[model samples]
Target: MDLTNFLKTGTYLKLKVGLSEENIYSCFKKKDLSKKYYYNKLDKNEGFSYFYGDGALEIMVIDSKIYSLQFDPARYPYILTLFNNIIISHKTSFELIIKYLDIADIKWSFYQRYCHSRELTIKTEENIFIGCVYDKGDYKLSKFQVFEDLYNGFF
Candidate 1:
């Protein structure tokens, strides 16, 4: 199955936040996914990680429920669409993302860059989280992530 099938209009794979691991796995029975344990430093939650398309797609299941989804722009650059089909490429800048969201009237806030080349995060009113990086004096797209809840570390 195309990894883009994981991305939907409202939620990732149409799976609601906090869906059990069993149900999530049932939906991907036809796909070959590899699982491993991952400790997310941002959320500080250790969960079962299932990767697809050779690390292009990843979903973190915490406590046997869907917790987070991460998409690598480098591999599947054209597949990451958001906020009502706003298409974005790997080259999409942080400014462009803000511009798109602002035009859509979607409320969002800058989390931080932390330091050079680090993940600069933005959280939308709809609970969508975007991760970017500072590169060559511009914030380039790093990864797009959807989590079950806001990171505890975020203020």
Candidate 2:
């Protein structure tokens, strides 16, 4: 599915990354797709929401450039059935994830500092860390986050 590109570009169907907001809006509008924008107190923080199926891509845009990307597989119907696509889910062990990423030598934490819940983080792509959050300490994957700007509290 070229998920790596999707992760990088923050758009499905192979859209160009680092494009202007005007360009993106024009492109999707021409294709008859709906998009939403959100802005908060921080001008450094702006987001665009593009909904497909039950899931949506909440892409962070700064200075009209795509900065970070995340996928909501929880709302996608085919996610669980596609077990082989474990890259986006927490269907495997944390140890195995670290082993697969070849970063086992680095310490693995049972809990994330932000949430105080057990979490596992492993590199999925260049500078991209996929974190699986286990809220109840069941050691099972409850949700996932695509972390590009780790400083933004996404870890």
Candidate 3:
């Protein structure tokens, strides 16, 4: 009955650890106007950086199959917002993390000195972690991140 097992097994945009660039591109929009990507020989991977609404997606692939991805914070005027039926950027928020994670229920250790804490990492029921890091002086959230266990045997 562990929810992490079910949640961690899921994919983003139906794109899993072994999906190709063509397979991934097929599942989402093809708006090259906002599409920006590159290939890194050192990593031996291709990267695509695409905008979604005011947010963005950065996908990385090696030998043609994706192994990692990221979602930027939610934004307004949502356009090309569908990443998957389960996870999303626009729906992502600190409150959303608490609703789905409830790390506090597990007695999980986290830091939140106040409403303006600089950073926080909440371990999720999915065995993944989502965080928002802030700029120190102004305490402005500078980054939104999702950390997932990397696929084994896949670099």
Candidate 4:
């Protein structure tokens, strides 16, 4: 299929990493990832609930209902701090950021619209409509600032 058609059909799928069911199961049983987190099997009549970090986040019930549970990075303040630090430290311009995203295998498209705004159309490999970036103004900045602006507006 053509790229546009393939994207529309959601034919792309992300490959699984080395993490396995058995490994996840063991971690759950032993509470290896975080002692504060725990999981319980749902009953046949009930839907599964994947709780994370003192039950602050739930994976949400779905059709099959079998899901792995663990600590959520968002639940910890340190995670956000670390993320912000990383984003700030990455000294990459908009051009370099786009290039790096391509190298990182992220599916995205870039466009220049008008003088003040640049558009960044993005999608997941699975054709999920991730979002876009519209550079409102202040396009010229240090590499770090450019990257920060893009990432800050990515969502």
Off by over 4 Å in 3: 1-9, 39-54, 79-96, 103-118, 125-127, 135-155
Estimate the lDDT of model 3: 0.44
Task: Give the winner by TM-score.
Answer: 1
| Highest lDDT against the true fold, candidate | 1
lDDT of 3 by residue, 50-116 (tens): 4544554455555666655554444434422222333434334556545544532422234332124
Better of 3 and 4 by lDDT: 3
How does candidate 1 fare on TM-score?
0.70
Position 122, candidate 4: lDDT: 44
* lDDT tens readout by residue for model 1, 17-63: 67787766665663667656467756646666888667766778888
TM-score of each: 0.70, 0.52, 0.51, 0.30
Model 1: lDDT of residue 125: 66
Pairs clashing in candidate 1?
none
Candidate 2, superposed: residue stretches over 4 Å from native? 1-17, 22-34, 41-45, 78-90, 99-116, 140-155
Q: Given candidate 1, what's the lDDT at residue 33? A: 78
- Ranking of all predicted structures according to TM-score, beginning with the best and ending with the worst: 1, 2, 3, 4
lDDT of each: 0.65, 0.45, 0.44, 0.31
TM-score: the better of candidates 3 and 4: 3
lDDT (0-100) at residue 31 of candidate 3?
72
TM-score of 3: 0.51
Model 4, global lDDT: 0.31
**lDDT at residue 87 of model 2 (Cα atoms):** 53
